[model samples]
Target: MRNKPGIKLTKEKRAEMISAIKSYYSAEREEEIGDLAAGLLLDFIIEELAPEFYNQGVQDSYNFMEKQLEDLLAIQKQ
Candidate 1:
C-alpha cells in the first residue's frame, strides 16, 4: 500500500508542539531534550502515530452521525 504524506503543521504550531514535548520530557521523565531532538520526535509522531489518532476521530464522528441519522429517520412522518 502507498503511504500517506506526513501531517503538516504551521511553523508557530510546530514550535509550540516542540516546546510542549520538551516540557513533557522535563516534567514527566526528568530528562531534558533539545529543540532538534524534540522536533524530530514530533515529526516521527506526525508520520507514525497521528494517522491512528486521525482514523479514530473519523470513526467516532461517523458513528455519532450514523446514530443521529437513525434518530432522524425514526421521527420521519409516515
Candidate 2:
C-alpha cells in the first residue's frame, strides 16, 4: 500500500527511527541529556512520523493508559 500524505515513512522505517531515538536517549551525553532527547522525540513524532496500524496498536494503547492514570490522579486531587 502507498504511504499517505502526512506520513513520510514506512512502518518499518518509523520503528527503526523510534528505536534509534530511544537508544540515543538511553545513552549518556556530553551536554543536556534527557531534556534535549525528549524534545526531539516529541517533535519527531508530532511532525515527521505518521501513525501506522502497528504503531497505533502499541503506542496508542500506552498513551491511553498513561492519560487515564493522569486523569485519575487529577480527579483524586480535586
Candidate 3:
C-alpha cells in the first residue's frame, strides 16, 4: 500500500504502537503476530476508523462546551 493517505506517527511512536498491537493480540487472543502484520493492521485501523473516532471526539467537545455554557449562564443569572 504505497502512498496510502494516512496520518504518520513518528518512528519511535510507531514502534511503540506496533508493539502494543502485538501485545494486544497476544494478551487478548493468545496469538502472536509479526511486526509486519501488526504494522499493517495498525495502518488499516488508522485509515478506516480514525475519521469516525475523530468525528466522535469533535462531537464530544461540542457537547462538553454546551454543558459548560449552560452552567455559566445559570450562574450569571443569579
Give TM-scores for every candidate, taking all chains together and pairing residue i with residue i. Answer: 0.90, 0.32, 0.76
Using TM-score as the measure, the top candidate is 1
Tell me which of candidates 1 and 3 scores higher on lDDT. Answer: 1
lDDT of 3 at 77: 50
Kindly report which residue pairs in candidate 2 clash with one another.
Answer: none
- After the best TM-score superposition of candidate 2, give how far the Cα of residue 37 lies from its true spot, in angstroms: 10
Clashes of 1: 0
Residue range 1-78, candidate 1, lDDT tens digits: 235776779999999999999999999999999999999899889888899999999999999999999999999889
Number of clashing residue pairs, candidate 3: 0
lDDT of each: 0.92, 0.62, 0.90
lDDT of 3 by residue, 1-78 (tens): 456666778999989999999999999999999999999998888888876898899999999999999988887754
Top candidate on lDDT is 1
- Taking the tens digit of each residue's C-alpha lDDT, what string does model 2 give over 1-78? 333355456767766666666666567443334545654574556555545555777898999999999988887743
| Model 3 error, position 36 (Å) | 1.0
Task: Give Cα distance to truth, residue 11, candidate 2, Å.
Answer: 0.1
